[model samples]
Target chain A: MITREEINNIALLSKLFVAENEMESFRTDMEQMMQFAQCVADADTANINTDDTASSSPMRQDKIGTSLTVQEALANTDASCDGYFVVKKNG
Target chain B: MGRIEQIHSLLCKKDISCRELTEEYLNAIQRDNPELFAYVTVTAQEALTAADKIDRQIAQGGDIGMLSGVPMSIKDNISTRGIRTTCCSKMLADYTPVYDASVWSKLKNSGAVLLGKANMDEFAMGSTGENSCFGASSNPYNTALVSGGSSGGSAVSVSANLAVYSLGTDTGGSVRQPASFCGVVGLKPTYGAVSRYGLVAFASSLDQIGPMASTVEDVSLVFDSIAGGDVLDSTCNRDYKPDTYKTLKDDIKGRTVGIIRQFADNNSISPEVKSSMNEAVKTFEDLGAKVIMVDIPEILRSVPVYCVISCAEASSNLARFDGIRYGYRAQGDFMSIHQLICKSRSEGFGKEVKRRIMMGTNVLSSDKCSFYYDKARALRQALSNEFSRAFSQCDVIIAPTAPTPAFVKNRVVADPTVLYMEDMCTVCTNLASLPAVSLPCGYSAQGLPIGMQIIGDKFSESLILNMAYKFQQATDFMRTSDWGVKL
Candidate 1:
């Protein structure tokens, strides 16, 4: 069972700020979701295995086909420095 | 003739202008699309201009692409160059992609008239279309019932005769389940058969763009046009091309088909779906086809495996939407940028999506990583192995597409698992990366439609379509969805 504090903690982990009006609804919804997820938890996977390896196509040779120029790229975004998409500083 | 054949005939004879046909469909959208809520954004002017060009080409006796002048709707998750692709969520309601999805580009290149973007489950997460922020898409058959989703609008548009055919992305049973509920043919091609370059990521490994149409023959025609290799989509199988689907009209005599013993359960399926399957089996058997029954217990665990893997992948894939440079950003006096992302996502994503993201995060958490997620992965392997063994015994497998007809609206929303269970019948095919088609079967006692899913070996779409076409010929269920016939 999820306590009120646990709900708050999960919301913190999920980065969702539960609104005052929505808290009760969130709590109820989360409990129902957990029950649904429990169905997955009930499966017996004793002898099963997983393939977690990442696979992808071979890297292409360094040849430009089509690309956005700095002006074209920055034209759409509000933030621009030499026409590239301005992103936040990595924390 | 089918919709595609009619469009081709009109173009070939110069009997009608492509622009006229495009305008006719646009008029239909203007008249009916609002109450239907089938489209998210309708590209009237652009489509008309494109049709004009195709008409010009035809008038000049110049060769045009196979799908010239045919109007089709695309699921909202696919990026169109100038059109807004909201994925039926408030987060990206105004977001427009600078680049086009590979499929959109192909359709545009083929001169297919774009009707507009269709609605879907928010970020392609839910099985029912009700999860959409735009609005719950009502079934064209009965407004009280739901259009099965996240590709609900795509299936609904075709079912309602709003568009001849439409595109839908299937992750789990998004395409086929909706098609079943809408009483149409929804084909989820083998994972890599269609390119995913433009489709917004849900679960990358499981997502596939497929055709939703009124008939298997129309689906085959569209499938042949769209299935091919693409450099933009790394996961696109280099194998599938027009030629692969072109040779699929042969008889199924001497071909092997399998019916999983577990799928025959009366309790798991509605009587209507079971009877439809029985009729399809008899039709297949009478056509000189060999039918066999086998039990694959691994299918029972498919739901759990699918949930774990899909949620895990969804968590990772959705990480791109962090209220950063693009998408909805929530600003507050007390919060930092990180807190803003949290708040933004919390507010932007709906209840079901947030729940899955949390479940995925929990499974991927370092402490319980191996316990829940890892175990689920192992089951996925076993499921794949079971499919491999089943395929070794037979060339194809047949089962009910869904347990029953589309339920009344808001019935399953109170408990989301009921919605997820809709995917139970369609998820196994995705787990094994097999091609499957949901063909309209008989109708439920309540007069709602039922469908049977014909699953084929990986990349064996030809055989699957052939079988579905034969079965469709034997039954009249597909032609009975007279949503517009005015009873």
Candidate 2:
């Protein structure tokens, strides 16, 4: 079960915020959803033989290719200046 | 003839100009879109320009390709340069890509007209089209019912005949389920059969760009056009191009069709879906195919497995949307950059997207990682192993594409878990990275379409398409509405 505090913590980690008005319903939904997720523990997976071997695709040879120009790349936002996206200074 | 071939014949024979065909689709969209809500954006001028070029080629007595002069829609999630690719989310409401997704580029080069960007669930997140920020697309069969999602608009475009065929990204049944609901064919190719170069990332591991159309032959034609290795997408499977379309009419006689053990006695599926599955099995038998029951017990837990894996992948993939670069940004003074990110994300994403991100974050957190995230992966391995063994006994597996047909709008809005539960029958294909196609087997008593998914082992699209072609030839399950251009 998720407490109100745990909801706040998860929200912070998720880079999101939960309003006080929506917190109760949101936490309830998450708790129920997590309960559904808890079904994984019920499966007989302990004896099922499986491995976690990582498979990596072969990386293509490094070569230069045509890419979006700075103007085109930054066209979607007004936060760019001098071919770089400008952001507020971090704390 | 398949819809694409028929349209192609008309163009090649000079019976109709491509410009007139494109205008017919554009006019249909203008008339029906406000109610059907199939398209998020209609690129009329672009479509007509492309059509005119195809017309010019045809006037010069040049032979045209199958997809030449065919009008189609691309799911809004697939990037179309200079056109709005919203993914049906407010977050990227004004976002347009700088380059075309490989699938769109492939179709564009083949002379397919773009009716517009099709609507979908926000970021391909929900099973129902209602999750789209723009609005849910109403089912063409019954306007009160939903077109299943996150490829709802793509399915609607084909079902309502707004476009001949469309491109939909299937990241866990987004393509097949909607196609099933809207009474069209959807192929979710093996994980890398189509390039993911410009398709917006949902669950990167599970996402595949696939073809949706009115018939299996048309689906194969579009798949032939789009499938191939791509330098842009390293993971694209190189062996699919110019293959399936050639063998589409091959015999499925003596092929073993497997039915999952759980689905045999499952109480969750509606009576209509079960009835349709029975009829589908009979049709396969009549076509001289053998039917066998295979046990894939782990698939019973697929919904949760899919939820955990998809949400986890989605959390990481969506982290790119910081207000600084692009997409929706919060307007206000913030004490810190972190505050801006939190505010922007909070306001930008829908409730479902935010919930998933939060749940994913919790699962991947230091303390909870072992319980949720790690456990889910091991279970996934077990699921994959189950599919591998099942395919050893059968050429393809069949399951009801969904537990039921399309739901009425707002039916599951009260409980998000109800929506999650609906992915049960379709997610296993994604989990195992297998190619699967959903074909209309029959319709419910309510007159909505019921589809059966034919799943093949990795890169076995040829067998699946051939089986679908045989089934379509044997059964008369395809239904269309009087919504789009008649011709």
Candidate 3:
């Protein structure tokens, strides 16, 4: 079972803020998921070589061509400066 | 002839104008979408415009493609320029891409009419399609049951005949499970066989865009149009020859099929699904194919392995949705950009997405990295090797797509682990980077559809399609379903 402190630490690393009301349920759900994932720890992986070449697509030519226009790129942003994305500043 | 070919012939002979066909689908969406919730946005005007172009081409005696003016739905995760491509998540509720996904572009260039964007689980995270902020899409067969998701809406649209066919992405069993529940044909091509340039990433290594249709022939047509390489997606297979549609009618005599002994075990699968597997085996035997039982012990651990790898990759893939650039941003004052990002994510993502992201972060954390994440990768490799050995004995592996048919909605929501177990049979193919297709083999006692999965070796889409085509021909599961929406 995972502790609440560890869940908070995970939220901090993941940049997700769990609400006060949902924290307990969230913690419980995470613990259950972790318990389910514990099967990986028990699996026998001795001498198992990870196949790096199992599935791969060919690389394209390293050449620049058409790209997203500045306006098109910033079309969905909430705020933008002159050809740059804008965000809140730290106090 | 198949529905797609029939429609093509109708258009070629000037029997039915593209405008009429498009209008028929639009009318169906208008009539049925209110109850089904299969579509998030309807592109009625754009579809009519495209249909007009096809009619003009036909008037000039110019040749049109096989899918020209065919009405279809695209799962919302695949980007369409100027069309909202929300993964049914609030984070990207308003995020419309500046360009189209590779698959969308290919279908568009083929003159396929766009009906609308189908709703899906937020970030393709959930199994029952209930995780969508847009509200869960109901099964066409039974409104009380789930449309097995993350491609639930796509499956429903095809099942209900709102569109002739639709495109869906399968990470684990998103396409196959829903396709099974809805009694449609869903194909998940081998990894790298289709480009993933504009698909919103869930798990980079496991995601593949596939087609859902009422018939294997239509699925083949859609797959042929979309499969191949794209310079934008270096992971797409450039050498893949999607020539399955041409030889889809080939006989399956003298073929060897391996049935996983574990799937038929009464403890794991329901009686209905087990009987369906038996009927499917008998059908193969009747078709002059040899059937043998094969065992892969590693497959039993696929769900846990999938959870670790997919969640870990999802945590990294979804980290891009900060409040800064695009998507839904929380409204409040915050001390730092980090706080802003946290707040945005907290408010933007649904419960399932958050849970997966947090679990992913936990497994990938420094303390648990080697013990959990690395071990899962090694086990995945082992599972892949086991599948390779199994394929050496048989051309394809047969199993139940899910342990049972679609369960009642919200029954398994309280326990996320139970829902995760539903992917047990389907995720093994994703872990092995193999192609698999799910077609309606039989129906449950209560009239719900049951899916039989046919999994092939890597890049063996043609073989799998041929097998599914033969099975479909021998069965009436696709044609016998009476739940389709009448337009």
Best by lDDT: 3
Q: Give candidate 3 misplaced runs (Cα > 4 Å).
A: A51-57, B480-487
**B146-190: candidate 1 lDDT, tens digit per residue:** 899889999988998777899999999999999999999999999
DockQ of each: 0.42, 0.69, 0.80
Model 3's CAPRI class is medium
| TM-score of every candidate's chain A | 0.59, 0.83, 0.85
How far residue A4's Cα lies from its native spot in candidate 1, in Å, is 3.5
lDDT against true structure, model 3? 0.90
Report the poorest 10 consecutive residues by lDDT, candidate 3 chain B: B478-487
Tell me the docking grade of candidate 1. Answer: acceptable
Candidate 2 residue-wise lDDT, B183-231, digit = tens: 9999999988889999889898899999999999999999888888997
Q: Report, for all candidates in order, the number of backbone clashes.
A: 3, 0, 0
Clashing pairs in 1: A48-B378, A49-B378, B101-B198
lDDT of 3 by residue, B1-487 (tens): 6678889998999998999989888988898888889999898888999999999999999999899988899999999998899999989988989999989999999999999999899999988988899899999888899999999999999999898999999999999999998899999999989999999999998999999999999999899889997878887877887899988989899999999976766377888898999999999999999999888888888999999999999999999999788988988888889988999999999988998989899999998998899999999888888888999899999999999999888784566888898898899999989999999999998989999999999999999999999999998897533444343
Q: Over all chains combined, what TM-score does candidate 3 have?
A: 0.98
